[model samples]
Structure formats: structure tokens, C-alpha cells
Target: MSEETVRSAKGRMGSFSFEGESAEGLLRIGEVTKSTGLTARTLRYWEEIGLISPIDHIENRERRYSGKVLERIDVIRRLQEVLGLSLAEVKAVLEQEDRLLEVVSRYRKDLDSGTRLVMLTEAKRANDEIVKRLDDRLSEIGRFRMERVERGQRIDSAIEQILREAND
Candidate 1:
């Protein structure tokens, strides 16, 4: 059986359904680019850097992606443009989120308290890591704003001093 077939089998087992997306249901690379308003090269580059992966259409060797992948692309855009994260930082955040999702999935099935506690702890750690990265970025922005404000004040003071000297 193909990987897609195996993924479909797993999907029926209640796992995340990323792998089993049918070709007919999948969007071609051009369609994805049009839907997301991203260029083809950008999508390919993101895939190259491990930020995103489009499913391969085995017959024609074309790239395809699911709706969930489109949602993930939106998240990636927000992380980069809104959160001011570098690609590396965005990747880190995505990894932590993926880990948290896995932990949540396993926690739902495992009835043992000890195992649940461990999973909970891991989830917390992943959440904290994401928070830390955001906090660090925010702090950097705050410092930059302060520096710009201070420079503007200094420039204003110099201009005022020059006016006084000229008037005297």
C-alpha cells in the first residue's frame, strides 16, 4: 500500500489527518499560491527550509497541499510579520506547538496518572518555551523604541540650544 493509503488508515484511527489527504482533495502548488497570496518561489523556499511541506502527487510529481497546510501557512505569515520572528524563531515556535499537540493527543488516550503527569509537564515546558521566545522579542522591540525616543529627545535639545545661542 502507498503512504497515502496508510495515512488514510491511520486517520480512521483518530490521529491527525495530515498524511492521508486525497489527491483530488488536495490543492496544486499554483492553487495554494493563489489562495494564500504567496509566490510559488516563496512556497518552494519555505518547503526547502523545512518551514512547510507540500504533499507530492506521485503520478505527475507535482506539489499539493491540504487545507490544514494553508492554515499553517497563514500561521507562519503571522509569526513572521506580526510577531517579528525570524524564520529560525518561527521554526522553533512551530516545533514547540507540534510537540504540545502530540502530548495533548497522547494524554487523551493514556489513563495512567504518572504518564499523564509527565505529558502535562512536557506540554507546560513547550508552552513556556514559546512564551519565552515571544517575550524576548517583545523586550527587544521595547528597547529599540526607547532608544529611538531618547535619540529624538537629544536631537530636540540640541536644536533648542542652537536656537538660544543664535538668539543671544
Candidate 2:
């Protein structure tokens, strides 16, 4: 893959390149790597984590990505590199985006006419959903931490009893 610099307003350097014939829309992992500068492993890992999914697979089970998935990969890159999100955070964002898509589908008619009420309602719902997800994640992590602390305490108790018995 070859890249040429893209000049922007802030004079920051960005690169763009074309994958031969493959940028025609649907792309394999290698083509995506060539065009987006993401590795095949990263793509597979994203898929494994449910962040992005390929559109189809070929005979030998090679992944094929759609245009939408490519856009998702772009968003994932921005979330990780620019926003400094961990994989868990990025997963939450992706899940929220998925919910937004569902909300958009449900309110397709309102969105078509650019209705403000429907838009605000859907946005609020999306925000609430994200909050709920984050709260649940925090609770889950807390529970795991508590379990580990309890185990450590049990170990310390056993060690203390052993030392006391030996002394007695």
C-alpha cells in the first residue's frame, strides 16, 4: 500500500491511499489493511469483540467486509487513538451505536421528515441505554474485585492460623 499526505486546516498530517480495484466497495481483510492501515489481526479482534463484523465469508472462511463495516472500523480507530478508549469502552460505544441504529430504524419516518421531537426522544433513549450499560459494567467489575479481596482475606487467615498452630 502507498500513501500520500493529506493537508488539513490545522496543518496536521493524514494519509490516504487506494487499494487497487478492491476499494471498489467490498473488501477482504488484506484490502482493508491496505486502505485503512489496520492489521488483519486488529480486524479479527474487533470482530471477535463484537465491535465490527464482516458482511460475509468465502469458501475457505475468509472474511469479507462491507462498506458499513469499513466505516465502523474508522470509528473504532478514532475512539481508540483519538479518544483514548479501552477495548471495553470502545465496545460500549459500538453497542450504543447499534442501539442508535435500531432507534433510527424504528423512527425512520420521523427521521425522513427531520422531526425534532422524534430525534430528541431517540437521542435520550440512546443516552439512557449507554448509561445503563456503563452502570452494569461497573457493578460487574466491582463484584469481581470483591471476590478477589475475599479470597485474599481467606488466604491470610489460613496463613495466620498455620503460624499460630506452629508456635503453640
CA RMSD of all predictions? 7.4, 8.7
User: For candidate 2, what's the RMSD?
Assistant: 8.7
lDDT of 1 by residue, 108-157 (tens): 99999999999999999999999999999999999999999999999999
Instruction: Give candidate 2 regions above 4 Å deviation.
Output: 1-24, 109-122, 128-168
Query: For model 2, what is the error of residue 15's alpha carbon versus the real structure, in angstroms, after optimal superposition?
Result: 31
Specify the highest-lDDT model's number: 1
Pick by TM-score: which candidate is best?
Answer: 1
Overlapping backbone residue pairs in candidate 2 total: 0
lDDT by residue for model 2 over 10-51, one digit each (tens)? 132123213332323455677667778888998888788889
Question: What TM-score would every model get versus the actual structure?
Answer: 0.82, 0.54
